[model samples]
Target: MPYPDEAVGFMADGPESFGTFTKRAYKLKPFEEFDIDVKVEACGICGSDVHTVSGGWGEQLFPLCCGHEIVGTAVRVGPKVTTIKEGQRVGIGAQAYSCGECKQCRNGNENYCPVNSINTYGSKWPDTGIVSQGGYGSHVRAHEHWVFPIPEALETTNVAPMLCAGLTAFSRWYATVPGRGRRLALGAETWAISRSRAKEADAKKLGADGYIATAEEGWEKPHLTSFDLIVNCANSSKGFDLPRYLSMMDVHGRWISVGLPEEEGQVIKAQNLISNGVLIGATHIGNRQEMLAMLKLAAEKGLRSYVEEIQIGEEGLKQAMQRMKKGDVRYRFILTGYDKHFARDLKI
Candidate 1:
């Protein structure tokens, strides 16, 4: 097999099923003067990757390597790049471009760039005509705007998932005011009730107020129609009883779906939602400013994701993907040792 000196990644031929990862080379051409080159050190596996590779997120560009939660060391500095330098540690999230002149850009929400919002993977770069590949590769090419300098105190492995998964969860929670009124986060005990007591205790350490072990306690029967908002983060689409969840919502309550499952996974009955007069909505990845704020808060509070580290290799990546599909990872999976895996293959 030939090598892609410019960008080496474990990729798939097309969107189909999970565990189709194969190491291949992505030919890199000269990027714009504002673009910077990064040697990837670590990356987090996002649910978006699962969705895209499994044909759940609609058709995708084939031969794609999707991993946006990237942490790396900068080895090439474009002449026009003023902030990032060679040998600096940085990160890039799900976004690759947001034309700065748009209405959304003038606001602090550039991630919503209405004109041209380029994703980190599976999209063509406006500046260089390069279809943006993701971070599961030997190196990444990013524009100056989307690249972020990571904090010294944070480990690359810990901060990688914050790029997407943590960011999504954080963005929703940050804007909320749990203190303004009575509030409690509800999760069915089936999800939280780990086999061991240690798992239950770990939940308390994370500051969950209470546990609703649905199988034994039957929260729905006792607290029927008792909630205002629910942020459903479960990724599986099957067995989601939309009416059962709706029954728990008070009149005019809201349900937001952030966790994406396979296509046609969650069948929604229009009548189920009509009874409560409730609204359903969801959010995408946060903006650059939000990413910076997320890192700052993470640094200040010493917050880090509970991630299992796996050495980067074809077999290792395949196992990680499989584990994620089965819901085995505690929180996130970050792949490291990119330099060792592709030492001879990296062109620059």
Candidate 2:
């Protein structure tokens, strides 16, 4: 695959009228010694993409092409990029560029490189000022460190979501590290919590032992001080009952939030933590080491993400975005058929 002068994709012109998309071409950031050019094969549609485009996350670059869970081929590797070879399958997640000299980067925490961590899309390159676009396009340019080689066992489309959604869920810090005996013996129970029981069957089928519907009367009483850890995945804080949820935590349990809702977050007070003394924290996307480990574990376990594939086009994108906003997707959605949508002259 030859590198192209312009990357083509469906761009949203404004947040006010976001779900609508238009096909357009945007220039890639200036090539750097450590950068790698990827010819995208598939890109997962993440909830964050929706938030950013709809102005939920905040103001963003206009006419933006939004996507972060990217899986593709290494079409061009800079001279200094030794880890990946041209034509090798690779993936890029949320973070694209991090200053390698930062203490966080040196300590295997590049995801938190506060000095200069660039997102896969929206963040502008320092010197070039070219906004970093994402996998909704035909090509993506990212630093070598941010790119990961895909395992042969994982299918391109199925593994795409793991770059973001899977990784985000996998990297959360669990308050209690259960011993191997209990983990292997299957004594620990799992439960799914939602606003309604409509998805109870689906949750059970996904291996949850029980389900909790918050809409039910006294939903929190029966499960009081029961859970050892709670990983919050709420996409909004509009009506979230923070104290009620925290009451379900066992003594000294932890609540780790991984979701980023565009709306204001629920407020917490000393009173909320004083009852159970539970800890609360949040995390960003996983680091590179975690990304590789996650991919390797998925490959070894033969893990597959639940994903619906949609062809790459304006109408397809529009439909996907609309459906995603309504929570119609079972798990994740991946945009495919790139070669059909992007012009052949672009050398995808």
What's model 1's lDDT at 26? 78
Off by over 4 Å in 2: 1-3, 172-188, 345-348
Clashes of each: 1, 0
lDDT of 2 by residue, 129-193 (tens): 99989999889999999999999999999999999888876763531145311221233588899
TM-score of 2: 0.93
Off by over 4 Å in 1: 1-5, 15-18, 127-129, 176-199, 214-217, 221-229, 247-254, 265-277
Q: lDDT per residue, candidate 1, 42-136, as tens digits?
A: 99989888878877778888788889999998878788999788899999888877888988899767877889888888887665666778888
**Cα deviation in Å at residue 306, candidate 2?**
1.4
Q: What is the TM-score of each candidate against the true structure?
A: 0.84, 0.93
